[model samples]
Target chain A: MRVLGVDPGLTRCGLGVIDAPAARTLTLIDVSVATSSADADAPDRLLAIADAIDAAILKHRPDAVAVERVFAQHNVRTVMGTGQVSGLVMVAARRAGLPVVLYTPSEVKAAVTGSGRADKAQVAYMVAKLLGLDEPPKPADAADALAIAITHALKGGGRTAASGASATPAQQRWVEAERAARRRN
Target chain B: MRVLGVDPGLTRCGLGVIDAPAARTLTLIDVSVATSSADADAPDRLLAIADAIDAAILKHRPDAVAVERVFAQHNVRTVMGTGQVSGLVMVAARRAGLPVVLYTPSEVKAAVTGSGRADKAQVAYMVAKLLGLDEPPKPADAADALAIAITHALKGGGRTAASGASATPAQQRWVEAERAARRRN
Candidate 1:
């Protein structure tokens, strides 16, 4: 399954594409950040981000799009921007006839680092290790985008059971963590 | 000048169009509310609202678009949706090559009823009187939308000077209130 993940924001939106070749194997297809000027009007900034997302969807042709869900509890200042960008992302995916799945930050962390409360560094390290990259993707947002994609690829839409049988030791841990998170929920 | 004003929301978005003829005289061109089901996904909801605004713009061919500014300070639960829809409105206006303007609720109220803190009823009453309608538009949203359009027509984007000389007694009060509001700002 090929998945496109987005960490939505008005100033800077992170995007990652990955291909799950096998149940336990993953390949990094693309990663980039889309940014807009702070000086621009809100609509223009959103339009720019929308264009970038649409371009990614056209280029990658991912089976599904994964996005970080915006919560009203935190980031009081940027929550609106995050929500607006998330809206644009969902619309772009839907327009392309692809399903969109949203994951919370904690869910992405647990999927990548085996801990819902994992810090940024730990999540970044795990993302780099899982994708077989020499280092974690830069600017944090990129890694986060990949982490969201990884979460969907591993356990999105309640499809976790299919990959359980072929899991390696590390994949087994993620599966266990996901199960725990589900139970907690 | 013809202005399309939007009071954006995810559940029900209010839209009003008006033509400013002979400085102070106003004509109501159109008023309608676009709605989306709460059961639909956020992206789909936004797209539906976007389509409505686009259709209005295409049909009215308004010279400018005006929208209520979404503030993070209020409506914590629905702020995100409001912001997202507002973004969509601005994008549609920009896409149609129409200038977009934003007015605060207080500004709209002040422009219509000569008081920034005026209640909804007062604003609605003044909207009907200004537009020479038999009664105020139904669904407070409709009235608010027209009020916003009236605000733009009366004093938007630092264009308050032109209409000042020919102001009637009521128009004079609105102009004075607007100046006071600007001074306070």
Candidate 2:
């Protein structure tokens, strides 16, 4: 299954696409960011984001779309922007006939790193190893988007058992992924 | 000029259309609410809202769109939903080549009822009086939407001085509107 993951934001939204053939295999298909200037009007910025996501959906034709859920934060303006982008992406995904799922930051971290409290560096490192990339994806947002996609592909695709340190191949993949993350860190 | 006012929400977004021939003259063209079920998936709910707003824009073809600017609140989920709807309406309005403006709740209240701290009843009463309607619009959401349109027409349409009690004809309109509100209360 090909999954598109979106880390929604107004200034810089991250997009990542990955194909998972089996529980133990993952391949990175594409990664990019959608950006809008802060000086532009709110409507124009929103349109720029919507158009970029629409293009990504058309280009990748992912089987499923996963979006990072916006959480309550101190900055109301930032939270508002995040929520708006999330809504736009979700609607666009549904319009394209793709099922949409939302994952919280902890959910993504637990799924990918076997710990809900994993830091950004650890998550990015795991993402690189999981996708067999030479280096971690840059700009943190791109790595986050890829992590969300990997989490959904592993969990939603119904190919992996519940996560743990057990010797199951899924667990083993995570262990290796974690080890790679440690090495890179 | 025709103005479309949107009170944004995820479950029930209120829409109001009004014709502003002059700063003092206004007519209500339409008032309604767009609803979505909480049981529906997020994407589907978002789509329902988008579709409803899109249809309103196509049907009304307003010259300007006014959306209630989302404010910080304790309810994160509610704020997120409201922000999403606001973004969708603004983008759709721009796509239709209409100018979009955002009014704070206090601004709408002051414009309609002569007090930024006016309660819902006061705003509703003024909305009914301003539109010369025999009865107040049902469903507070619809009434708020109408109030928003009236505020934009009174302010953005260049009828009133900057929100004060000077006895311009615009101020006179406010005095009458406020008197009407007090009578209803």
What would the TM-scores of all predictions be?
0.83, 0.84
For the predicted complex of model 2, DockQ is: 0.30
For A1-185, candidate 2 gives per-residue lDDT tens digits of 89899999999999999999885699999999999988776777898998999999999999878889886565675888888999999888878987777888999999999999999999999999999999999989899999999998777442221221013344357656766777999
List the per-model TM-score of the A chain: 0.85, 0.83
Question: Per-residue lDDT of B1-185 in model 1, one digit per residue for the tens?
Answer: 88898999989899999999654799999999999987766666777888899999999999778899887768888887888888778767767866677788887888889999999989989999999999999898899888988888887333332321223345457767878997999
Best candidate per TM-score, number? Answer: 2
lDDT of 1 by residue, A13-132 (tens): 999999987646878999999999877666677778888999999999998888998876678899888988887787677778776777889989999889999999999898889999
Tell me the lDDT of model 1 at A86.
85
**Candidate 1 backbone collisions, by pair:** none
Instruction: Report the number of clashing residue pairs per model.
Output: 0, 0
Model 1: lDDT equals 0.82
Candidate 2 chain A weakest ten by summed lDDT = A158-167
